[model samples]
Target: MALKPHRSPRRVNLISPADRIRPDAASVLLKMVEEPPPDLSFIMIAEDLDAILPTLRSRCVLLHARKPDPEAAASWLEAKGLKDFDEQLAEAGGNPLAVIRGHKIVPDEARALFLGLLKTGKRLDITKVAPGVGTGWKLDACADFFSRWGTDLIRVKSGLQPSYFVGETPELQSIAPGADLQRLFHWLDETESLKRASSVPLNNKLALEKILESYRSVFRS
Candidate 1:
């Protein structure tokens, strides 16, 4: 019956069933649903609506959010031309909002460095790579790229999809058939976790070297 904002300041009044329900508390929540407030509208959001009471469902005016226009989504995919589009979408939990936020958060310099590394045949010195890959914003940028690259490689190995940032490197493709993509994924996970727990350590050079070395080893094998 009462309304309030989701966040602080309470500028908007929104109500949800999840906020008021409790175990062992005898309350007629159904009544509130049955007779909503006058001069106000009620909106119910659920991933699965089968659990709601039949009477409540019957009385409710169901309004479903329309799916994104296929042509618009296709235009977006065409713009990126990413081989791992599905993977990125998956990482963003299939939510278009999350995908946009994720892309927006990517650092421009970090992206440039990634392209540079790939072009150098994985031969770029750690000294040169450090400035581009160092821990900034709590090592977030580096960790995100690392994870995304690893995921792309894993997808390639599984024969499910191509990689977004990956290219047809003769050297890489020659050895990729014999490479251990799973091992690389595990190492990426370990490095990401370490970077997160280290409180932005001073040895970013060492971290960059380890990451590149591990990646080079994948193609070398």
Candidate 2:
């Protein structure tokens, strides 16, 4: 008789950002999910469902959560005593929970350092950025910032106001002239790829260095 591993009466395996799961990890998870114990349940959440593995996605019942009302969400955050979240709230496209998650996950200092580097353009020192947002989930945060900032650069170049970082219009205007629009667009794609990959275990400093290298390259003549 095989030895049985002890488990509770009910078990749930939760995977958020399901699309970021490594292929090998997904294969192992697939096995358990395929023939999971009756008491086991898997709940997966993803920002982009199509990016998740089809086999795994097919096994679960899908449900979509509606976006919360922005005004209500802002009120809730205010009631919780959170101020200075208006930027994150707008950045999240009015998704209140995302604003809260971002606030808790990243430090304010790291955010300031990143934006300062963005304004530095070709002079951006990678050493300064490495410590600010190079570890663990901070890497993901930095990647998200760069990806969105790249979009704002596009808006500025096109004579439209930025959606995020409306407060940084002067800085964006200063940097936009130096950046090639085509390269900025390409950098956006690269930043997104890096953000998705940041979830995996890797050298945090090296990853930030690589991403910031591409950021400098966008301004190449």
Candidate 3:
């Protein structure tokens, strides 16, 4: 697509967030940034500067962004008239914008369902959780939840603090003892891959079933 023509004499600001631009898009953007029109300015934001293409990074000034403190982020959310600010802030990993926009998927129902699956251990019925594996943001969120659950299981096994579900230590402790680390790590890797592939059109139900079934295998009798 040709760059949208900007009328002369009017200042234009082009802002691109990190990870949203593919390599081809970055190439096109590089040309514009290299020889920007007199009235045009570009601002590119990235969570990891190193992840940005070297060609793109070379053409612009770099700025590092720091995540806000959880307490401060919670306070800001509360000031914005949001309830459960602390929980939201933690769910967002202290990202101020995520907290403000409330983009993180609410995991209450999913967590409850997952906890039941964990309680069943080796006999978990993947079919039960399969129906809840929705597409779009919900599927992405479900994959993330599993990843965090995997992390918490590892933490419990290794005698460390659980970052996601701190209140579920007892349950985590019970499950952690029989968790096969090799299988758990494999499942974690698979969840991450699914998360990255979420943008593409997928059979969300089948994908979710595969993930849950794999998760069921992580626990040994």
Top TM-score prediction, candidate number? 2
lDDT of 1 by residue, 106-193 (tens): 5667666765674443454556676665345345446566666566566656664434443433433434465576677776776566
Backbone clash pairs in model 1 (N, Cα, C under 3 Å; residues 3+ apart or in different chains), count: 0
lDDT of 1 at 170: 43
lDDT of 1 at 32: 60
Query: Candidate 2 residues 1-221, lDDT tens each?
Result: 12343676676767887877877888888888898877767888887686677898888898998776868988999988889888788677567877767643356666677778888888788888666663345666677777778888899989998877777889899888889888888888888788778767768777878888889888865
Model 3 steric clash pairs: none
Better of 2 and 3 by TM-score: 2
Write the residue-wise lDDT of candidate 3 on 80-145 in tens digits: 888866555555556768867657654566667776786666788977876764334366667777
The lDDT ranking, best first, is 2, 3, 1
Q: Would you list the clashing residue pairs of candidate 1?
A: none
Q: Give residue 37's lDDT in candidate 1 (0 to 100).
A: 58
Reference-based TM-score of each model: 0.48, 0.75, 0.71
* Candidate achieving higher TM-score, 1 or 3: 3
